[model samples]
Target: MTRQDISELYRGYIDCLNRQAWPELGRFVHQEAQYNGQRIGLSGYREMLENDFRAIPDLRFVIDLLIADPPHIAARLCFDCTPVGELFGLPVNGKRVSFTENVFYEIRDGRIAQVFSVIDKEAVRAQLGNDSP
Candidate 1:
């Protein structure tokens, strides 16, 4: 896929995620996907997302930054929501917090094949009443 094509595809993926359209995930994610070097495949990926939604009912991925380079995509996903309990090991406990997640993805065969993600735990901690990193 070209740069524009990949970028559009990623936007579609984000839309799907925001909509929680699990059945349509396969259109953007490969059947054999890997996340953070672990081969979770598409089902695991969906489950992870579902679990995230369960933890944060108002979860929504806001794209603060997006960079697409053919098979690679680097995205800064921002979130502003309240977690029911611990989040990123922090005691959020339904406190509203805003954080960013830096993620990288490898697209293969026009679908996401691999993903690497890092969430801003410190930001969440700060917003949750603890400033210490």
Candidate 2:
């Protein structure tokens, strides 16, 4: 896929997530997808996303930055939401917090085959006033 093609595809994938269109996730995520290093297939991927939405009902993925390099995509996804309980093991407890996730994706056959993601947990911690360390 061309750089533009991959970027558009990624944007579409983000749109699908924002819509919470679980059924359409297969179009963007490979059946044998891997998250971080674990091989969490499409079903597991969907479940993870579902759990995220359940925790933060207002969760929305906003792309603050995006770079498409053929089969690879690097993105900075920003989030501003309130979590009902713990988020990344931090007690957000319905408090609004803003953070960014730096994620890299490897697209295979136009579907996401692998994902390496790191969320800004320290940002959440600071927001929650738990900055010990």
The most accurate candidate by TM-score is 2
Q: Pick the candidate with the highest lDDT.
A: 2
Predictions: Cα RMSD each: 1.0, 0.7
Q: Write the per-residue lDDT of candidate 1 for residues 1-133, one digit (tens) a residue.
A: 8889999999999999999999999999999999999999999999999999999999999999999987899999999999998888888888889999999999999999999999988888777678776
**CA lDDT of each prediction against the hidden true structure:** 0.94, 0.96
Error of 1 at 32 (Å): 0.8
Cα deviation of 129, candidate 2, in Å: 0.6
